[model samples]
Target chain A: MSDKKTITFPVEATHVMMFRRSIGDYAVPDTGLEKAAVPPTFPRAVAQFDPDYHLRLKPGEAWFGSGKKPSGVEGKPSSAGGLHAEQHFEFLRPMVPGDVLSVTEHVGKTWEKESKRAGKLVFTERVQEFRDQKGELVCISRGVSVRTERPVDQK
Target chain B: MRLKASQISVGDTFEDILVEDLKRTQLVMYSGTSGDYNPLHTDDIYCREAAGYPGVFAHGMLTMGMTGRVVTDRFGAENVKKYGVRFTNQVWPGDDLKGKAVVDAIRQENGETLIDMTITTTNQKGDVVLSGYATARAEK
Candidate 1:
Protein backbone atom coordinates (compact mmCIF):
# COMPACT_ATOMS: atom_id res chain seq x y z
CA MET A 1 0.00 0.00 0.00
CA SER A 2 2.99 2.26 0.41
CA ASP A 3 3.84 2.33 -3.28
CA LYS A 4 0.58 3.69 -4.65
CA LYS A 5 0.41 4.08 -8.38
CA THR A 6 -0.42 7.54 -9.63
CA ILE A 7 -1.42 8.61 -13.14
CA THR A 8 -0.71 11.96 -14.71
CA PHE A 9 -3.85 13.48 -16.20
CA PRO A 10 -3.25 16.59 -18.28
CA VAL A 11 -6.69 18.06 -18.63
CA GLU A 12 -7.30 19.11 -22.22
CA ALA A 13 -10.08 21.35 -23.44
CA THR A 14 -10.95 18.98 -26.29
CA HIS A 15 -11.29 16.14 -23.82
CA VAL A 16 -13.58 18.27 -21.71
CA MET A 17 -15.58 19.21 -24.80
CA MET A 18 -16.04 15.59 -25.77
CA PHE A 19 -16.92 14.69 -22.19
CA ARG A 20 -19.55 17.41 -21.98
CA ARG A 21 -21.03 16.27 -25.28
CA SER A 22 -21.05 12.68 -24.12
CA ILE A 23 -22.93 13.64 -20.98
CA GLY A 24 -25.29 15.81 -23.07
CA ASP A 25 -24.48 19.03 -21.20
CA TYR A 26 -25.02 21.51 -24.02
CA ALA A 27 -25.63 24.52 -21.80
CA VAL A 28 -22.15 24.31 -20.32
CA PRO A 29 -20.40 25.04 -23.54
CA ASP A 30 -16.77 23.96 -23.70
CA THR A 31 -15.88 27.25 -25.37
CA GLY A 32 -14.06 29.47 -22.87
CA LEU A 33 -14.57 26.67 -20.35
CA GLU A 34 -10.93 26.76 -19.42
CA LYS A 35 -11.79 29.79 -17.36
CA ALA A 36 -14.86 28.05 -15.99
CA ALA A 37 -15.37 24.63 -14.44
CA VAL A 38 -16.26 21.34 -15.98
CA PRO A 39 -19.28 19.22 -15.10
CA PRO A 40 -19.45 17.91 -11.56
CA THR A 41 -18.77 14.42 -12.84
CA PHE A 42 -15.83 15.57 -14.93
CA PRO A 43 -13.36 13.86 -12.62
CA ARG A 44 -14.66 10.49 -13.79
CA ALA A 45 -12.86 11.07 -17.09
CA VAL A 46 -9.55 10.39 -15.34
CA ALA A 47 -9.85 6.84 -16.59
CA GLN A 48 -8.77 8.11 -19.97
CA PHE A 49 -5.49 9.16 -18.43
CA ASP A 50 -4.81 5.94 -16.51
CA PRO A 51 -2.53 3.86 -18.64
CA ASP A 52 -3.33 0.70 -16.68
CA TYR A 53 -7.06 1.19 -16.51
CA HIS A 54 -8.40 -2.31 -17.04
CA LEU A 55 -11.76 -1.31 -18.47
CA ARG A 56 -10.24 0.15 -21.61
CA LEU A 57 -8.97 -1.91 -24.50
CA LYS A 58 -5.21 -1.84 -24.81
CA PRO A 59 -3.07 -2.60 -27.81
CA GLY A 60 -1.75 -6.18 -28.11
CA GLU A 61 -4.10 -7.20 -25.34
CA ALA A 62 -7.20 -9.28 -25.98
CA TRP A 63 -10.39 -7.48 -25.06
CA PHE A 64 -13.55 -9.06 -23.75
CA GLY A 65 -15.72 -7.30 -26.30
CA SER A 66 -17.12 -9.22 -29.21
CA GLY A 67 -15.44 -9.46 -32.60
CA LYS A 68 -15.93 -12.80 -34.41
CA LYS A 69 -17.32 -14.27 -31.22
CA PRO A 70 -19.31 -13.14 -28.28
CA SER A 71 -16.05 -12.47 -26.46
CA GLY A 72 -12.61 -11.96 -27.86
CA VAL A 73 -10.85 -13.35 -24.84
CA GLU A 74 -11.46 -16.99 -23.97
CA GLY A 75 -13.29 -17.97 -20.79
CA LYS A 76 -14.20 -14.40 -20.07
CA PRO A 77 -16.90 -14.46 -17.47
CA SER A 78 -20.28 -12.97 -17.95
CA SER A 79 -20.73 -9.53 -16.43
CA ALA A 80 -17.11 -8.81 -17.11
CA GLY A 81 -15.28 -6.07 -15.21
CA GLY A 82 -18.02 -6.10 -12.55
CA LEU A 83 -20.83 -3.55 -12.17
CA HIS A 84 -20.66 -0.06 -10.76
CA ALA A 85 -22.50 0.07 -7.47
CA GLU A 86 -21.93 3.52 -6.04
CA GLN A 87 -19.95 6.66 -6.76
CA HIS A 88 -19.27 9.71 -4.62
CA PHE A 89 -17.30 12.82 -5.42
CA GLU A 90 -16.09 15.58 -3.11
CA PHE A 91 -14.63 18.63 -4.74
CA LEU A 92 -12.60 21.19 -2.84
CA ARG A 93 -12.45 23.10 -6.10
CA PRO A 94 -13.95 22.64 -9.55
CA MET A 95 -11.90 20.72 -12.06
CA VAL A 96 -10.69 22.96 -14.83
CA PRO A 97 -9.86 21.72 -18.31
CA GLY A 98 -6.45 23.37 -18.33
CA ASP A 99 -5.22 21.93 -15.04
CA VAL A 100 -2.92 18.94 -14.98
CA LEU A 101 -4.13 16.55 -12.29
CA SER A 102 -2.04 14.07 -10.41
CA VAL A 103 -4.44 11.19 -9.89
CA THR A 104 -3.95 8.31 -7.51
CA GLU A 105 -6.26 5.43 -6.66
CA HIS A 106 -6.14 2.84 -3.93
CA VAL A 107 -8.33 0.04 -2.69
CA GLY A 108 -10.57 1.10 0.16
CA LYS A 109 -12.82 -1.71 1.37
CA THR A 110 -14.13 -5.15 0.43
CA TRP A 111 -17.17 -7.10 1.43
CA GLU A 112 -19.36 -9.96 0.24
CA LYS A 113 -23.06 -10.61 0.16
CA GLU A 114 -25.45 -13.29 -0.95
CA SER A 115 -28.15 -12.63 -3.49
CA LYS A 116 -30.77 -15.04 -4.68
CA ARG A 117 -30.54 -13.98 -8.29
CA ALA A 118 -26.90 -13.07 -8.69
CA GLY A 119 -25.62 -15.48 -6.04
CA LYS A 120 -22.50 -14.34 -4.24
CA LEU A 121 -21.80 -10.66 -4.70
CA VAL A 122 -18.36 -9.34 -3.88
CA PHE A 123 -18.09 -5.59 -3.60
CA THR A 124 -14.86 -3.69 -3.85
CA GLU A 125 -14.41 -0.02 -3.18
CA ARG A 126 -11.81 2.25 -4.72
CA VAL A 127 -10.90 5.81 -3.78
CA GLN A 128 -9.31 8.21 -6.26
CA GLU A 129 -7.89 11.62 -5.44
CA PHE A 130 -7.19 14.32 -8.02
CA ARG A 131 -4.51 16.80 -7.07
CA ASP A 132 -3.53 19.82 -9.11
CA GLN A 133 0.05 20.52 -10.19
CA LYS A 134 0.51 22.59 -7.06
CA GLY A 135 -0.03 19.35 -5.10
CA GLU A 136 -3.20 20.82 -3.67
CA LEU A 137 -6.15 18.52 -3.32
CA VAL A 138 -8.74 19.26 -5.95
CA CYS A 139 -11.18 16.38 -5.66
CA ILE A 140 -11.77 12.95 -4.20
CA SER A 141 -13.84 10.28 -5.91
CA ARG A 142 -15.04 7.08 -4.30
CA GLY A 143 -16.49 4.29 -6.40
CA VAL A 144 -17.82 0.89 -5.42
CA SER A 145 -17.93 -2.06 -7.81
CA VAL A 146 -19.83 -5.31 -7.38
CA ARG A 147 -18.89 -8.61 -8.92
CA THR A 148 -21.77 -11.02 -9.20
CA GLU A 149 -21.34 -14.75 -9.21
CA ARG A 150 -23.41 -14.82 -12.36
CA PRO A 151 -25.39 -12.53 -14.56
CA VAL A 152 -28.10 -10.76 -12.63
CA ASP A 153 -31.34 -12.58 -13.18
CA GLN A 154 -33.54 -10.52 -15.45
CA LYS A 155 -36.79 -11.31 -13.77
CA MET B 1 -27.92 29.63 -11.15
CA ARG B 2 -26.48 29.65 -7.66
CA LEU B 3 -28.44 28.36 -4.74
CA LYS B 4 -29.00 31.09 -2.24
CA ALA B 5 -29.62 29.98 1.35
CA SER B 6 -31.98 32.88 2.02
CA GLN B 7 -34.10 32.12 -1.03
CA ILE B 8 -34.36 28.38 -0.39
CA SER B 9 -35.94 26.25 2.30
CA VAL B 10 -36.02 22.64 3.34
CA GLY B 11 -38.47 20.44 1.40
CA ASP B 12 -37.99 22.60 -1.65
CA THR B 13 -37.05 20.65 -4.75
CA PHE B 14 -35.76 21.10 -8.27
CA GLU B 15 -35.59 18.67 -11.12
CA ASP B 16 -34.80 18.16 -14.77
CA ILE B 17 -35.48 15.57 -17.43
CA LEU B 18 -32.11 14.01 -17.85
CA VAL B 19 -32.80 12.13 -21.05
CA GLU B 20 -35.67 11.06 -23.26
CA ASP B 21 -35.41 7.51 -24.59
CA LEU B 22 -31.79 7.01 -23.64
CA LYS B 23 -29.80 5.94 -26.68
CA ARG B 24 -27.06 3.38 -27.01
CA THR B 25 -25.01 5.82 -28.97
CA GLN B 26 -24.74 7.93 -25.84
CA LEU B 27 -23.27 4.95 -24.06
CA VAL B 28 -20.67 4.58 -26.78
CA MET B 29 -19.96 8.25 -26.57
CA TYR B 30 -19.44 7.98 -22.82
CA SER B 31 -17.08 5.08 -23.28
CA GLY B 32 -15.18 7.06 -25.85
CA THR B 33 -14.88 9.94 -23.44
CA SER B 34 -14.41 8.11 -20.14
CA GLY B 35 -12.36 5.20 -21.50
CA ASP B 36 -14.78 2.63 -20.11
CA TYR B 37 -15.17 0.32 -23.09
CA ASN B 38 -16.78 -2.49 -21.12
CA PRO B 39 -18.69 -4.54 -23.69
CA LEU B 40 -21.69 -4.91 -21.39
CA HIS B 41 -22.49 -1.29 -22.05
CA THR B 42 -21.89 -1.11 -25.83
CA ASP B 43 -21.86 -4.62 -27.24
CA ASP B 44 -25.29 -6.10 -27.73
CA ILE B 45 -23.99 -9.38 -29.05
CA TYR B 46 -21.73 -9.79 -26.08
CA CYS B 47 -24.62 -9.10 -23.79
CA ARG B 48 -26.92 -11.56 -25.49
CA GLU B 49 -24.66 -14.36 -26.65
CA ALA B 50 -21.93 -14.20 -24.07
CA ALA B 51 -23.62 -12.63 -21.05
CA GLY B 52 -27.13 -13.64 -20.23
CA TYR B 53 -29.21 -10.51 -20.59
CA PRO B 54 -31.62 -8.74 -22.84
CA GLY B 55 -29.13 -6.44 -24.58
CA VAL B 56 -26.56 -3.73 -24.02
CA PHE B 57 -27.39 -1.48 -21.06
CA ALA B 58 -26.20 2.01 -20.29
CA HIS B 59 -23.21 2.40 -18.05
CA GLY B 60 -24.06 3.35 -14.48
CA MET B 61 -21.60 6.20 -14.86
CA LEU B 62 -23.57 7.43 -17.85
CA THR B 63 -26.70 7.69 -15.77
CA MET B 64 -24.76 9.43 -12.99
CA GLY B 65 -23.15 11.73 -15.51
CA MET B 66 -26.43 12.62 -17.13
CA THR B 67 -28.13 13.08 -13.82
CA GLY B 68 -25.33 15.41 -12.75
CA ARG B 69 -26.56 18.14 -15.07
CA VAL B 70 -29.43 18.98 -12.77
CA VAL B 71 -27.07 19.37 -9.83
CA THR B 72 -24.56 21.52 -11.67
CA ASP B 73 -27.34 23.60 -13.17
CA ARG B 74 -28.88 24.30 -9.82
CA PHE B 75 -25.84 24.57 -7.59
CA GLY B 76 -23.28 25.67 -10.15
CA ALA B 77 -20.49 23.19 -10.70
CA GLU B 78 -18.06 25.20 -8.62
CA ASN B 79 -20.37 25.29 -5.63
CA VAL B 80 -20.89 21.58 -5.51
CA LYS B 81 -18.75 20.27 -2.68
CA LYS B 82 -20.05 16.72 -2.59
CA TYR B 83 -22.06 14.59 -5.01
CA GLY B 84 -22.76 10.90 -4.69
CA VAL B 85 -25.10 8.21 -6.01
CA ARG B 86 -25.84 4.52 -5.84
CA PHE B 87 -27.01 2.53 -8.86
CA THR B 88 -30.33 0.96 -7.92
CA ASN B 89 -31.42 -0.54 -11.23
CA GLN B 90 -30.05 -1.14 -14.69
CA VAL B 91 -30.69 1.50 -17.34
CA TRP B 92 -31.64 0.29 -20.78
CA PRO B 93 -31.90 2.03 -24.14
CA GLY B 94 -35.13 3.88 -24.78
CA ASP B 95 -35.62 4.47 -21.09
CA ASP B 96 -36.38 8.03 -20.14
CA LEU B 97 -34.83 9.44 -17.01
CA LYS B 98 -35.64 12.31 -14.68
CA GLY B 99 -33.38 13.61 -11.94
CA LYS B 100 -34.40 15.46 -8.82
CA ALA B 101 -32.69 17.14 -5.90
CA VAL B 102 -34.63 17.87 -2.74
CA VAL B 103 -33.40 20.33 -0.17
CA ASP B 104 -32.92 18.33 3.00
CA ALA B 105 -31.29 20.92 5.18
CA ILE B 106 -29.50 24.27 5.16
CA ARG B 107 -26.97 24.84 7.81
CA GLN B 108 -23.89 26.82 8.78
CA GLU B 109 -20.55 25.09 8.47
CA ASN B 110 -17.20 26.78 8.99
CA GLY B 111 -19.02 30.11 9.08
CA GLU B 112 -20.32 29.40 5.55
CA THR B 113 -23.82 28.28 4.70
CA LEU B 114 -24.24 24.87 3.00
CA ILE B 115 -27.13 22.95 1.51
CA ASP B 116 -27.66 19.23 1.93
CA MET B 117 -29.89 17.62 -0.62
CA THR B 118 -31.10 14.22 -1.64
CA ILE B 119 -30.56 13.09 -5.23
CA THR B 120 -32.73 10.64 -7.09
CA THR B 121 -33.04 9.66 -10.73
CA THR B 122 -36.02 7.68 -11.90
CA ASN B 123 -36.95 5.85 -15.06
CA GLN B 124 -40.22 6.06 -16.97
CA LYS B 125 -41.57 3.17 -14.92
CA GLY B 126 -41.07 5.13 -11.70
CA ASP B 127 -38.18 2.87 -10.85
CA VAL B 128 -35.30 4.62 -9.14
CA VAL B 129 -32.16 3.97 -11.13
CA LEU B 130 -29.84 6.15 -9.10
CA SER B 131 -30.20 7.55 -5.58
CA GLY B 132 -27.80 9.51 -3.39
CA TYR B 133 -27.13 12.85 -1.74
CA ALA B 134 -25.22 16.04 -2.41
CA THR B 135 -23.87 18.91 -0.38
CA ALA B 136 -23.18 22.28 -1.89
CA ARG B 137 -21.99 25.63 -0.65
CA ALA B 138 -24.83 28.11 -0.88
CA GLU B 139 -24.74 31.87 -1.07
CA LYS B 140 -25.93 33.46 2.09
Candidate 2:
Protein backbone atom coordinates (compact mmCIF):
# COMPACT_ATOMS: atom_id res chain seq x y z
CA MET A 1 0.00 0.00 0.00
CA SER A 2 1.26 3.44 -0.95
CA ASP A 3 1.44 5.39 2.31
CA LYS A 4 1.21 8.83 0.77
CA LYS A 5 -1.16 11.06 -1.23
CA THR A 6 -1.26 14.65 -2.52
CA ILE A 7 -3.90 17.24 -3.34
CA THR A 8 -3.94 20.93 -4.30
CA PHE A 9 -6.60 23.62 -4.00
CA PRO A 10 -7.12 27.35 -3.77
CA VAL A 11 -8.13 29.20 -0.62
CA GLU A 12 -11.42 31.07 -0.71
CA ALA A 13 -12.31 34.06 1.43
CA THR A 14 -15.89 32.93 1.83
CA HIS A 15 -14.81 29.60 3.21
CA VAL A 16 -12.38 31.25 5.60
CA MET A 17 -15.14 33.51 6.81
CA MET A 18 -17.43 30.55 7.28
CA PHE A 19 -14.81 28.92 9.47
CA ARG A 20 -14.41 32.11 11.49
CA ARG A 21 -18.14 32.30 12.01
CA SER A 22 -18.43 28.63 12.80
CA ILE A 23 -16.09 29.14 15.75
CA GLY A 24 -18.24 32.05 16.91
CA ASP A 25 -15.77 34.79 16.08
CA TYR A 26 -18.69 36.91 14.99
CA ALA A 27 -17.25 40.18 16.23
CA VAL A 28 -14.15 40.02 14.02
CA PRO A 29 -14.99 42.88 11.71
CA ASP A 30 -14.80 41.78 8.09
CA THR A 31 -12.60 44.76 7.39
CA GLY A 32 -10.00 43.57 9.88
CA LEU A 33 -9.39 40.51 7.73
CA GLU A 34 -9.44 42.28 4.38
CA LYS A 35 -6.27 40.47 3.36
CA ALA A 36 -8.11 37.17 3.78
CA ALA A 37 -5.77 36.30 6.61
CA VAL A 38 -6.99 33.11 8.20
CA PRO A 39 -6.82 32.04 11.81
CA PRO A 40 -3.97 30.00 13.25
CA THR A 41 -5.65 26.63 12.72
CA PHE A 42 -7.03 27.58 9.30
CA PRO A 43 -4.96 24.98 7.50
CA ARG A 44 -7.17 22.23 8.88
CA ALA A 45 -10.17 23.95 7.33
CA VAL A 46 -8.48 24.07 3.95
CA ALA A 47 -7.77 20.34 4.11
CA GLN A 48 -11.47 19.55 3.87
CA PHE A 49 -11.32 20.72 0.26
CA ASP A 50 -9.55 17.50 -0.63
CA PRO A 51 -12.10 15.11 -2.08
CA ASP A 52 -10.68 12.11 -0.22
CA TYR A 53 -10.83 13.82 3.17
CA HIS A 54 -13.15 11.53 5.07
CA LEU A 55 -12.85 9.16 7.98
CA ARG A 56 -11.59 5.93 6.37
CA LEU A 57 -13.01 3.62 9.00
CA LYS A 58 -16.62 3.48 10.09
CA PRO A 59 -17.49 4.86 13.51
CA GLY A 60 -18.96 1.66 14.93
CA GLU A 61 -15.98 -0.41 13.92
CA ALA A 62 -13.08 1.57 15.40
CA TRP A 63 -12.04 1.45 19.04
CA PHE A 64 -12.26 5.16 19.76
CA GLY A 65 -15.37 5.11 17.59
CA SER A 66 -13.79 7.24 14.80
CA GLY A 67 -10.75 7.35 12.45
CA LYS A 68 -9.44 8.22 8.98
CA LYS A 69 -9.80 5.38 6.50
CA PRO A 70 -6.51 4.79 4.72
CA SER A 71 -6.97 5.29 0.98
CA GLY A 72 -5.60 3.05 -1.79
CA VAL A 73 -4.38 0.68 0.86
CA GLU A 74 -5.20 -2.93 1.63
CA GLY A 75 -4.68 -5.06 4.75
CA LYS A 76 -5.71 -2.11 6.88
CA PRO A 77 -7.68 -2.86 10.00
CA SER A 78 -11.47 -2.83 9.51
CA SER A 79 -12.59 -2.76 13.12
CA ALA A 80 -14.22 0.48 14.25
CA GLY A 81 -14.45 2.82 17.31
CA GLY A 82 -11.76 5.49 17.66
CA LEU A 83 -11.27 9.13 18.58
CA HIS A 84 -9.13 12.00 17.35
CA ALA A 85 -6.39 11.55 19.90
CA GLU A 86 -4.14 14.52 19.20
CA GLN A 87 -3.34 17.34 16.77
CA HIS A 88 -0.18 19.32 16.03
CA PHE A 89 0.60 22.14 13.65
CA GLU A 90 3.59 24.14 12.43
CA PHE A 91 2.85 27.32 10.51
CA LEU A 92 5.88 28.29 8.51
CA ARG A 93 4.18 31.08 6.62
CA PRO A 94 0.91 32.90 6.36
CA MET A 95 -1.87 31.87 3.95
CA VAL A 96 -4.31 34.13 2.20
CA PRO A 97 -7.15 33.95 -0.29
CA GLY A 98 -6.19 33.20 -3.91
CA ASP A 99 -3.15 31.26 -2.77
CA VAL A 100 -3.04 27.71 -4.07
CA LEU A 101 -1.76 25.16 -1.60
CA SER A 102 -0.40 21.76 -2.49
CA VAL A 103 -0.70 19.33 0.35
CA THR A 104 1.12 16.01 0.70
CA GLU A 105 0.00 13.56 3.35
CA HIS A 106 1.77 10.42 4.52
CA VAL A 107 1.17 7.88 7.23
CA GLY A 108 3.61 8.22 10.09
CA LYS A 109 4.07 5.79 13.02
CA THR A 110 1.47 3.07 13.59
CA TRP A 111 1.47 0.81 16.61
CA GLU A 112 -0.70 -1.10 19.04
CA LYS A 113 -1.03 -1.35 22.81
CA GLU A 114 -3.28 -3.00 25.37
CA SER A 115 -5.96 -0.96 27.09
CA LYS A 116 -8.29 -2.05 29.85
CA ARG A 117 -11.40 -0.50 28.35
CA ALA A 118 -10.90 -1.44 24.68
CA GLY A 119 -8.59 -4.45 25.03
CA LYS A 120 -6.19 -3.80 22.10
CA LEU A 121 -5.79 -0.25 20.83
CA VAL A 122 -4.28 0.67 17.47
CA PHE A 123 -2.82 4.12 16.92
CA THR A 124 -1.94 5.86 13.65
CA GLU A 125 -0.40 9.23 12.90
CA ARG A 126 -0.74 11.10 9.62
CA VAL A 127 1.41 14.07 8.62
CA GLN A 128 0.41 16.63 6.01
CA GLU A 129 2.76 19.22 4.53
CA PHE A 130 1.35 22.31 2.85
CA ARG A 131 3.18 24.41 0.25
CA ASP A 132 2.03 27.54 -1.46
CA GLN A 133 1.84 28.43 -5.15
CA LYS A 134 5.30 29.99 -4.85
CA GLY A 135 6.54 26.63 -3.62
CA GLU A 136 7.25 27.96 -0.15
CA LEU A 137 6.35 25.76 2.79
CA VAL A 138 3.28 27.08 4.58
CA CYS A 139 2.31 24.62 7.25
CA ILE A 140 2.79 21.08 8.55
CA SER A 141 0.02 19.30 10.42
CA ARG A 142 -0.03 16.01 12.30
CA GLY A 143 -3.18 14.15 13.32
CA VAL A 144 -3.26 11.08 15.52
CA SER A 145 -6.15 8.65 15.27
CA VAL A 146 -6.69 5.74 17.64
CA ARG A 147 -8.90 2.71 17.01
CA THR A 148 -10.24 0.24 19.52
CA GLU A 149 -12.95 -2.37 19.91
CA ARG A 150 -16.31 -1.10 21.06
CA PRO A 151 -17.76 -2.47 24.26
CA VAL A 152 -20.25 -5.28 23.72
CA ASP A 153 -23.18 -3.18 24.84
CA GLN A 154 -22.43 -0.36 22.37
CA LYS A 155 -22.18 -2.78 19.49
CA MET B 1 0.50 43.12 17.30
CA ARG B 2 3.78 41.32 17.66
CA LEU B 3 4.84 40.81 21.25
CA LYS B 4 8.36 41.52 22.27
CA ALA B 5 10.03 38.50 23.81
CA SER B 6 11.82 40.68 26.32
CA GLN B 7 8.62 42.52 27.19
CA ILE B 8 6.76 39.34 28.09
CA SER B 9 8.02 37.66 31.24
CA VAL B 10 8.01 33.93 31.75
CA GLY B 11 5.05 34.13 34.06
CA ASP B 12 2.99 36.60 32.03
CA THR B 13 -0.55 35.42 31.36
CA PHE B 14 -3.27 36.72 29.14
CA GLU B 15 -6.62 37.47 30.67
CA ASP B 16 -9.19 34.74 30.32
CA ILE B 17 -11.56 35.13 27.42
CA LEU B 18 -15.01 33.63 27.50
CA VAL B 19 -15.90 31.65 24.43
CA GLU B 20 -19.44 31.53 23.27
CA ASP B 21 -21.53 28.72 24.70
CA LEU B 22 -21.48 25.51 22.74
CA LYS B 23 -24.59 25.25 20.61
CA ARG B 24 -26.06 22.61 18.33
CA THR B 25 -26.35 25.18 15.57
CA GLN B 26 -22.63 25.95 15.83
CA LEU B 27 -21.78 22.26 15.62
CA VAL B 28 -23.96 21.91 12.54
CA MET B 29 -22.26 24.95 11.07
CA TYR B 30 -18.83 23.46 11.71
CA SER B 31 -19.97 20.14 10.24
CA GLY B 32 -21.09 21.89 7.09
CA THR B 33 -18.05 24.13 6.84
CA SER B 34 -15.47 21.47 7.59
CA GLY B 35 -17.32 18.78 5.59
CA ASP B 36 -16.95 16.38 8.51
CA TYR B 37 -20.40 14.81 8.54
CA ASN B 38 -19.70 12.41 11.37
CA PRO B 39 -23.14 11.48 12.69
CA LEU B 40 -21.66 11.65 16.18
CA HIS B 41 -21.34 15.42 15.85
CA THR B 42 -24.54 16.26 13.99
CA ASP B 43 -27.09 13.54 14.60
CA ASP B 44 -28.20 13.30 18.19
CA ILE B 45 -30.24 10.17 17.63
CA TYR B 46 -27.38 8.42 15.94
CA CYS B 47 -24.98 9.48 18.65
CA ARG B 48 -27.25 8.36 21.46
CA GLU B 49 -28.63 5.19 19.87
CA ALA B 50 -25.69 4.01 17.80
CA ALA B 51 -22.51 5.64 19.09
CA GLY B 52 -23.50 5.43 22.77
CA TYR B 53 -22.85 9.10 23.45
CA PRO B 54 -25.40 10.83 25.63
CA GLY B 55 -26.01 13.34 22.84
CA VAL B 56 -24.26 15.04 19.97
CA PHE B 57 -21.11 16.91 21.07
CA ALA B 58 -18.95 19.66 19.62
CA HIS B 59 -15.99 18.63 17.54
CA GLY B 60 -12.67 18.81 19.37
CA MET B 61 -11.37 21.00 16.57
CA LEU B 62 -14.15 23.44 17.32
CA THR B 63 -12.97 23.81 20.88
CA MET B 64 -9.34 24.13 19.82
CA GLY B 65 -10.17 26.74 17.23
CA MET B 66 -12.09 28.82 19.72
CA THR B 67 -9.34 28.54 22.29
CA GLY B 68 -6.77 29.55 19.69
CA ARG B 69 -8.29 32.98 19.53
CA VAL B 70 -6.73 33.70 22.90
CA VAL B 71 -3.32 33.57 21.32
CA THR B 72 -4.06 35.19 17.99
CA ASP B 73 -6.02 37.96 19.62
CA ARG B 74 -3.04 38.86 21.82
CA PHE B 75 -0.29 38.09 19.36
CA GLY B 76 -0.79 38.25 15.62
CA ALA B 77 -1.80 34.99 13.99
CA GLU B 78 1.18 35.23 11.68
CA ASN B 79 3.52 35.08 14.63
CA VAL B 80 2.36 31.66 15.73
CA LYS B 81 4.94 29.02 14.84
CA LYS B 82 3.55 25.98 16.62
CA TYR B 83 0.18 25.03 18.13
CA GLY B 84 -1.07 21.72 19.40
CA VAL B 85 -3.67 20.19 21.67
CA ARG B 86 -5.01 16.97 23.14
CA PHE B 87 -8.72 16.33 23.48
CA THR B 88 -9.23 15.75 27.19
CA ASN B 89 -13.00 16.03 27.50
CA GLN B 90 -16.12 16.39 25.39
CA VAL B 91 -17.89 19.72 25.11
CA TRP B 92 -21.66 19.43 25.16
CA PRO B 93 -24.32 21.88 24.09
CA GLY B 94 -25.08 24.69 26.56
CA ASP B 95 -21.60 24.41 28.01
CA ASP B 96 -19.87 27.77 28.39
CA LEU B 97 -16.11 27.80 27.96
CA LYS B 98 -13.31 30.16 28.93
CA GLY B 99 -9.76 30.10 27.64
CA LYS B 100 -6.49 31.51 28.97
CA ALA B 101 -2.97 31.49 27.59
CA VAL B 102 0.11 31.84 29.78
CA VAL B 103 3.67 32.49 28.83
CA ASP B 104 5.67 29.49 29.89
CA ALA B 105 9.09 30.52 28.65
CA ILE B 106 10.94 32.97 26.43
CA ARG B 107 14.18 32.18 24.69
CA GLN B 108 16.36 33.11 21.74
CA GLU B 109 16.93 30.58 19.01
CA ASN B 110 18.40 30.89 15.54
CA GLY B 111 18.76 34.63 16.16
CA GLU B 112 15.04 34.95 16.75
CA THR B 113 13.19 35.44 20.01
CA LEU B 114 10.43 32.93 20.68
CA ILE B 115 7.85 32.62 23.42
CA ASP B 116 6.34 29.39 24.63
CA MET B 117 2.78 29.38 25.90
CA THR B 118 0.46 26.94 27.57
CA ILE B 119 -3.23 27.16 26.83
CA THR B 120 -6.14 25.83 28.84
CA THR B 121 -9.88 25.96 28.26
CA THR B 122 -12.42 25.14 30.93
CA ASN B 123 -16.16 24.66 30.90
CA GLN B 124 -18.45 26.52 33.29
CA LYS B 125 -18.19 23.55 35.60
CA GLY B 126 -14.43 24.28 35.77
CA ASP B 127 -13.58 21.10 33.94
CA VAL B 128 -10.57 21.44 31.69
CA VAL B 129 -12.04 20.43 28.37
CA LEU B 130 -8.85 21.07 26.39
CA SER B 131 -5.24 21.89 27.12
CA GLY B 132 -2.29 22.55 24.82
CA TYR B 133 0.88 24.46 24.16
CA ALA B 134 2.08 26.89 21.51
CA THR B 135 5.24 28.68 20.39
CA ALA B 136 5.43 31.98 18.56
CA ARG B 137 8.07 34.38 17.30
CA ALA B 138 8.30 37.50 19.36
CA GLU B 139 9.51 40.88 18.15
CA LYS B 140 11.84 43.45 19.75
- Cα lDDT tens digits, model 1, A21-133, are 88888764557445555777888888887777888888999988889998998887787889999999998987877889998888899999999989999999999999999
TM-score of chain A of each: 0.91, 0.71
lDDT score, residue A103, model 2? 84
**Predicted candidate 2 versus true structure: per-residue lDDT over A29-114, tens digit per residue:** 56534554577777777547676555423334432232242222333333323667678999887777778898888899999888
Q: Identify the leading candidate in terms of TM-score.
A: 1
TM-score for each model? 0.95, 0.83
Candidate maximizing lDDT: 1
Considering every candidate listed, which one attains the maximal DockQ? 1
Root mean square deviation (Cα) for candidate 2: 5.8
Which segments of candidate 1 are over 4 A away from where they belong?
A: A1-3, A30-34
lDDT of 2 by residue, B16-115 (tens): 5556566799998987777666666776655655555677788888888888888876666777889999877778898999988899888888898888
User: In candidate 1 chain B, where is summed lDDT lowest over 10 consecutive residues?
Assistant: B69-78
lDDT of 1 by residue, B1-140 (tens): 76677888999999999999888899999999988888999999999999888999998999998888887877777788999999999999999999999999999988978889999999999999999999988866
True contacts kept of 1: 0.87
